[model samples]
Target: MDQTEKNVQTLFSMGFLDIEDIKNALRISHNDLSEAVAILTNDQVRYGPYSSAGPAEDVEMKDVTSTALVPTAAPPPYNSLPDAKPCSPKPDYGNTAFPQTNLYELEQRVFVDQWSIPYKKDESLAKCLIAATSLAKEGNHP
Candidate 1:
């Protein structure tokens, strides 16, 4: 279906009253579906779908889902990490900028060695880590 028809259907699902009110909300919101819903549901808003008398007094005050009222943060402009797919010949192997990409493998090896390594490190660091791991196991950890 077209834009107007789709909007009307969405409003109807949310318990909004009348085609005129939906149309007015759609216009006010510039045809954004979330904005339209928010406009229709808002108690103080002019183009809302509530009856002239308004909502029932005895009805439970439940949390309403309205996207327009919530402030949304914009996504980051660029990704820092390279994309890698599973079972590929060389998944992100060319990315020398970020070498420690296979963190899972490193962690697995560390655990297998009784959590000795902790991270990918030089021989000196590895020796220190092994000593630290022993200390930790003996309750004199640092």
Candidate 2:
């Protein structure tokens, strides 16, 4: 296996699937958090933000029967069943960036004038602001 795969295996074997461990093992920045998480999916170790990655890599897949092979033919259509309606496309809400009303300009100005002046470690605030912007873009509130 390649270096990345081996590293993932070693980390998984050592139970280093938590966000901090994954970040350190993968050398992933906060900005690339989603991408880092995607790697876990390849190893069948899906994990939510608040949930730990499930199971371990060394486990084997269970032997299963072929349900498809034993399947019977489809039954005749019943007259009592209602006709399936065509699904209509959802309405497109035009591109609307949020807090929607340029309120972030004030925050931007404050950031520029205060914290950003001396280049302080404002990553937390920056992430929050960026998240707010993303939420607005998705038509969701902060």
Clashes of each: 0, 0
RMSD (CA, angstroms), candidate 1: 19.7
User: Against the correct fold, how does model 1 do in TM-score?
Assistant: 0.30
The residue-by-residue lDDT of candidate 1 on 1-142, one tens digit each, is 9998898888888888788878877766668788777666764564334533244322223456663565555432222213322322323322223223344434544454233332324322333445555556668633
**What ranges in model 1 sit over 4 Å off?**
43-142
Angstrom error of the Cα, residue 71, model 1: value is: 32
Candidate 2 total steric clashes:
0
Worst 10 residues of 1 by lDDT: 76-85
lDDT of 2 by residue, 1-142 (tens): 7666655566566555664456443653222434454544443444333334344322223455654555555432322224322222431234334322223333443453222211122222333455566676678864
Residue 34, candidate 2: Cα error in Å is 3.4
User: What is candidate 2's local distance difference test score?
Assistant: 0.41
What local distance difference test score does each model get?
A: 0.52, 0.41
Q: Can you give the lDDT of residue 71 in candidate 1?
A: 52
Could you say which candidate leads in TM-score? 1
